[model samples]
Target: MKRLIARALRRLGWLRYDLLISPVAQHPGKNAVPPGELWLVIDTGVKKWACMSCPGGCGVQIALSLNPDRRPRWSVETDFWGRPTVSPSIHQHRACSCHFWVKKGVIEWCR
Candidate 1:
């Protein structure tokens, strides 16, 4: 059911993933982030970090820092409909090595 909806959204030029914002200091728990979704944990009322599963089907969770004081951090922008666009690009340096861009709910893969 969820997978079908995600695929339909992707086919419609929307992102297969959605953003789930949580105003908490710690990750809610395991399974808090669904597949094809990004969880933004806002700490101190500021965007502190973002987490999402590897889109490459590796089943690994990627954590990106949103803190401006940190180097190599990324920022997220939300559209009027609440879709998220992550600036620059995300490149995993570890296993999978998946690199891609999340723009307006679509994942554009890189070579």
Candidate 2:
């Protein structure tokens, strides 16, 4: 069933979804990670650099550092909501296979 699949994916750490149990503003200066140029080092050598901006519309650039030695990493660019967030983008969207990750954190590189 769909629920079973979601659970399995979650257990594997490949899926993420969030309900705003608390508002971003509630944490104020605590969770005040700026939207753009956000870098998350998920595990030991896996790092993700996300830069987001809005000129007329939102744009997101995501880069992955897959190796500990590599300073120059591969990158991709797309619209906002490129990853799962508390607020989903009105522009880009989730694919059927990736809907779950969007809600933990997901998107870009056309995977």
Candidate 3:
């Protein structure tokens, strides 16, 4: 099955996610984010938001607030290799309800 193959590829470290930084303050359009890429929005040197397409294969875009002053905000840290680690798991309350954590560019799906 495709899911099994994907898991195998992940285990073999062939599959990994990437982070892309954008200085534009506006929200990314539906097709702006490519698969396996997370976009970080920065405005005037302030971290604004993180955007990415849903990993659940539903093609929905998810945006999380990066401002520490806002409630339910998430923080992102990157290693020397530019691999990102996001604190606190991301849980989609609607849609496919996919929940996961991004650590070092790897998605750890939550059950």
Best candidate (score: lDDT): 3
Global fold similarity of model 1 (TM-score)? 0.73
Model 3, stretches more than 4 Å misplaced? 1-25, 29-32
lDDT of each: 0.72, 0.33, 0.75
TM-scores of the candidates in the order shown: 0.73, 0.20, 0.75
Instruction: Report how far residue 83 has shifted in candidate 1, in Å.
Output: 1.3
Q: What is candidate 3's lDDT per residue for 13-97, written digit by digit as tens?
A: 8855444333356768665577766777888888788888888888788888999999999998765445568788999777899
In Å, residue 53's CA in model 3 sits off its true spot by 0.6
Error of 2 at 75 (Å): 14
> Candidate 2 versus the native: TM-score?
0.20
Q: Write the per-residue lDDT of candidate 1 for residues 1-111, one digit (tens) a residue.
A: 554665577679765454433334665355545665677777777887777887887777888888889898999886644456888799987778999998866678998
Better of 1 and 2 by lDDT: 1
Please give the distance, in angstroms, between residue 67's alpha carbon in candidate 3 and its true position after superposition.
Answer: 1.0
Lowest summed lDDT window (length 10), candidate 3: 15-24
